[model samples]
Target: MGIVRLIDRQGNRHELQALEGWRVMEILRDWGMFVPPRCGGSGQCGMCHVKVAEDWSGKVLPPGELEAKVLPLLPGRGETSRLSCQILWSETLDGLTVALP
Candidate 1:
């Protein structure tokens, strides 16, 4: 298992241990965090967009398909943007910190 930290726009932090290979968005919806699953966890919706401050987790970024479509529609879209449904958690991501926009 790996630890993932999610911070809201207000600077609130939420930390959880995620299973390896599960995408970041999967954890959010599975744990029923505040994430609004407008498309039922589908990669099409940009509602689950979050900011990855540092992703040393070695989590392979999902293919350009989902991100290419979702990132631009969201509020915070810098270098680190993985459609919550697209990111898979890895052991290296134990201390990963992300800010939800």
Candidate 2:
């Protein structure tokens, strides 16, 4: 398992315990964060957008083809923008930090 820290739009910080191989969105939703998995983690909806913290951005897995197609369409997308539903938890991301965009 790993720790995933999230900052909401209002600047509220939340930390969640995430299991390996689980999607980031799954962990966030399980913790009752405000992430809207409108597409049920299928990467069809852009509601699960989150920006990886700069320090850990480089460590995050690269976006897949589906995410690449959807992320740019969302408002406020940045270099660190990612679809949480598509991010798998891993030891390398133990202290990962992300913020709702």
User: Cα miss at 59, model 1 (Å)?
Assistant: 5.6
Point to the candidate with the largest lDDT. Answer: 2
Per-candidate Cα lDDT values, in order, are 0.73, 0.91
Tens digits of per-residue lDDT, candidate 2, 5-93, equal 99999998988999999999999999889756879999999899999999988898799999999998999999999999988999989
TM-scores, all candidates, are 0.78, 0.94
Please give the clash total of every predicted structure, in order.
4, 0
lDDT of 1 by residue, 1-101 (tens): 87888786678788887999887888876766766668866778888787677544245554577668777777767777667776767886776787676
Q: Tell me the TM-score of model 1.
A: 0.78
Give the runs in model 1 whose Cα sits over 4 Å from its true position. Answer: 55-59
- Model 1 Cα shift for residue 44 (angstroms): 0.5
Q: Model 1 scores what on Cα lDDT?
A: 0.73
| Ten-residue region with minimum lDDT total, candidate 1 | 54-63
